[model samples]
Target chain A: MRVTFPHMGTMSFAMQAILENLRLEVVPPPPITNRTLMLGAKYSPECVCLPFKVNIGNFIEAIELGADTVVMGGGIGPCRFGYYAELQQEILHDLGMRVNMIVLEPPQGANGGLWSSISKLSVGQSLWHVAAASYFAWHLCKGLDGVLQSLDLMRARETVPGSCDRIWNAAQKSIGQARTYRALRMAEKEIRQELSTLSLHLHKRPLRIGLVGEIYMLLEPKVNLHLAERLGYLGVEVHRSMSVSDWVARHLVPNPRARMHTRKVHEAARPYLRGFVGGHGLETIGESVLFAEGGIDGIIQVLPLTCMPEIVAQSLLPSISQRYGVPIITLVLDEHAGEAGLQTRLEAFVDMVGARKVHRGGGVSCAK
Target chain B: MPSKIFLGLDVGSVSTKVVAIDALGHVLARSYLPTQGQPIVAIQSALREIARALPPGVPVAGVATTGSGRVMASALVGADVVKNEITAHATATLRVLPSVRTIIEIGGQDSKIILLNHGVVTDFAMNTVCAAGTGSFLDRQAHRLGVPITELGELALKAASPTRIAGRCAVFAESDMIHKQQTGHSLSDIVAGLCEALVRNYLSNVAKGKTIAGPVSFQGGVAANVGILKAFESALALPIIVPEHYDVMGALGVAYLAQPTAGQTRFRGFGVVAADCQVKGEDCDGCGNRCEVVGFRIDGRVQAYWGDRCGKYSHVNYLSVGT
Candidate 1:
């Protein structure tokens, strides 16, 4: 059976590896573009968040590319994401696209759990085989996330403007083509060495900006309008509060380190928000406080329009900013968001953060 | 003639402002003209007027561009610095009133609140995805009421008891105004009601969660409306300081920003007033992005390209023309 899934940043690489290792034919959806957004919006309900629309578009494209089975993740929360897969399946059936959808819901009571869903795709593969593939895929994802985190820091200080971006694109391409676990390790090593070789301005202390918001918006560059890259080019070091590896460790894997990190985040958010407001709303507040206390120059919350959890988080950001003396900006994006307007806001925000840092006697060497 | 002068251009949606300032920030010449949906022509005409006001051979030491059309204006005029309107407006306001703490700027299509502390912007907010609380709504209401747009403020000031109108959205505001008009409210009261409603919308929306301290300054096109100014004064309980060049503050501020780029200026001079420029848009089907790349041409040679997500088109170093 040909299997397909939506793209979420570099998560596709790890997913593709898992499917290929399981001996399933993988039809990866094309890289997200404007066409993807337009196609998704055309089919999606008017007021759904941007990620849902984009996912619809991915499914359509994949179905057209001869993918007969679609894999989607399920959630149980106040967020609309829990109902997306079921609604999307209905829409696809109405469109006369005959496709089997396997939603891997969270391993809860009476649910067949993740392994049961995987077994359906695996067909005759043994449980041992499935676990081994997952193990390799998990490690690959962890390594890739580490590379990306370092790249974020290096982008701001690169001696050459576009060198880091070039290295990143090349790394993604190689990672996609790597077949074996050893091959993946080789690619990661080469990329790490290549990144270290790129000359960077050592003395330049770039402004630090933490990005916190919805998971989809944080992970998807197209949805966020390449925000991290843009900020890096503006000579600001970007730190993402969420990543795929982090998500896996917190939710899927049973890791003490990840649990400790989650507890710390919850504790940080306690004074501002006590309960989970669904999605990443609570985490966004928690990360902002952590970043502020860490002495970051600024914080930016990126959320899609009509996002409920983020709306709740957005209301409390002003108080946090006031208390911590950290400037914060919230960008609400939708299909109608213009590139020029986003650029203007980012430029003005960077300038404000730099000026505030300078005024506060923080010697930040701003490079234009 | 001043030995070194700087030029600033603010090409907004509704108006285009140009200002030339001397080394000491004194205005050498200034002009404001309607953009009227044609920014290039408006820019050329504004520059021609400024050229006429200045000495024939006076050289512009530096040039900067601001406002919504900053990137396009920068390319068209060879701006030494391309800055956003927020910074530009703040820069100009601080230059005039060093101790100013808050700035309320309501322009044709956008409004912003900037809070400053000791000559640096501490925080700021702009209206997002909505134009309900801006000057365009007032202009539209005036047009519908059959009064000249310029006379709206004076007409509003004539009201003894202003009526109430909704200001949550432009459509709602229009319908509410129509309902009040049909219910036999005086024209002046309705107009005055609009002024107050807009101020209320601005304060609750754009300036939400912002602290407006004393020594507040009001600038931008809407600041000219005396009725709105009064509403602001009463709402905040503080006198609003309107700079002498309030309407062109963005242009004035950018001119100040261009001061440091003295010796090496990219100003194309007054000659750009006559330069033949054209912009052509074409869709690139290289990938699914289908970016609508726009090429800026001067004298039949492509000088720059923009609008592509990937740098394939924009990064091309085409030979410069008319520099």
Candidate 2:
């Protein structure tokens, strides 16, 4: 009865057990690199989305390791996730893999139930087995997330070479062993505490920037070019709207986002948005407006070019900039690169942001 | 002058991620999470994580964001540099493996192929219209098979004779797989066929007319699968290399980008968790493209702007048009 999760891209939060029961076994896939991506692309259909290559690659790798059962959710709606299970299963079969592929739809949906159903299957079975496994998985995810959070803080201020990597490796090891909820909680707390003692001092003059983009690229340092750490070295506090825990708390759950702010989501979205409305871009638009209100200095948008939702936003982003009078720079990506050229562009953009901030006052400020 | 740091952020339909690095392209810290429908929540969470995860005392000097949410993330983080996923992914790849000629990234919702020249991206292709071959597809398939997604690769490897199946779309693929099973094709064969079909599908879809050079890397969240790895090795007629921390490379790339930017960063301080917000979109009657316009507001301010064909609604900066 080995349970598994598909590659979540950079959404580490899914590693958590989520529900009160059913412990999860966190599978550690080989880290993503140029080679890894190539392997995925090699076998995956050229027309397929990028995630297919990576996930199929991961599935192949895991199968070779002698695992039997694979698990995943059956999603629905505009985004392609709803039907992912079928295609991937077919691909696995075509690749000659033999194992049970379980598609878990939301508890209440067109597809059969999953999480709650898994919970229901717990009836008369060993609750301890479910609880223990779920606990272990949940703790590991929590511990890892907690540790990663602190590591990001340190990276923001780190000036010396190898410091960020050193802390990250240590933190990874510390959280990997997290067993129980309490243990995870302790380990995370300790990791953060230990990280607080870096030699680099916070400069009050750090620039404040807002980060928004596609989910996977936003969080995966390997994918997003390590922008936050670079900003930290420059004495700036990086602000990004995406986070790990926030996912479990916000979108994953079956409900509309709580309207905590007075600014209603502009009625501009009349009807197409009944319910969750798919991607986070819609939500990010509102969040960017909020950042403007919060007095964040400027904005940077990062996303895959073929991405429709983001592209749609990209088409309309000028309005956001004009409305808020904020500086915005955009970068589209696929895989190939000219690092030097990109660095030059980034340098120029930062200079512009700094210049604008200076013009605003000694430091940009938003009146409370 | 003291060394400067860099920041990279990737926001996708499913998740929003952030990363930070130093001048020499070393990773500092990274965060991964589901987008939860609100980019603000994702940004706030990423920032707070940065506040806690980065080297305790160093202050960020510059920031850049990549991904669908880059502009909004840039705004939230006060980014100094804002770039797209392609540039960010390409930049970060070069930073790590200086001579990578080809890159293939497949995440939860989409897939892309990038060709690089001495670390510079020359051409690339992406698939956003299809869910037929993405991580979410694997997630869904794994669920149907009643196996954990982590074991998909292992299970795939166990096939004696991989099954040949159609994979043009999920529905078609699934029905075909079931039909093959009904015809008594060995499970192993069925799996193999399915794999081949997916490869075929990818070739015709995302990789059409794209030349793939060697020194290739298979990255993104899905690179962990061994079954797919074998398929790739066979297709490319070359060995594929998967990097450690492959799942977070985009973040790493953007984080690396943040370091070399000039002057100071514009990233906001952490601890900003946007209050839960409800956002929506409307069909803007403002011209053709009948763009179903969308916008977001937090605490009563329109922060995010999207939905336009001719950049009419996209005007973030005052265009000097007709000036």
lDDT per prediction?
0.88, 0.61
Please provide, for model 1 over B194-307, each residue's C-alpha lDDT reduced to its tens digit, 9 standing for 90 to 100: 999999999988888888998999999999899899889899999789989999999999999999889988777778899899999998986545668999888987767887
Q: List the residue pairs that clash in candidate 1.
A: none
Residues A1-368, candidate 1: write the lDDT tens digits: 89999888778888998899998999999878778889999999999999999999999999999999999988877788888999999999989999999887876423666777888888988989988888888888887788789988988898755677778777777765676878988888888889879999999999999999999999988788889888997899999999998998898879899989899998999999999898899999999999999999999999998999999999999999999999999998888788777888899899999989987895532211
Q: Quick one: best lDDT, which candidate?
A: 1
- Candidate 2: residue B91 lDDT (0-100): 66
On TM-score, the candidate that comes out on top is 1
Candidate 2 wrong stretches, greater than 4 Å = A1-4, A9-27, A106-112, A116-143, A150-154, A159-161, A233-235, A253-277, A337-342, A362-368, B1-323
DockQ of each: 0.45, 0.02
Q: What would the DockQ be for model 1?
A: 0.45
RMSD of model 2 against the true structure = 23.2
For model 1, the superposed segments whose C-alpha errors exceed 4 Å read A108-111, A362-368, B282-290, B308-323
Q: Please give the range of 10 consecutive residues that has the lowest summed lDDT in model 1 chain A.
A: A359-368
> How do the residues A228-336 of candidate 2 rate in per-residue lDDT, one tens digit apiece?
6555544456787665544443533443553333124433322223244445566556656767768887776776545555555555555666667676665565544
Question: TM-score per model for chain B alone?
Answer: 0.97, 0.84
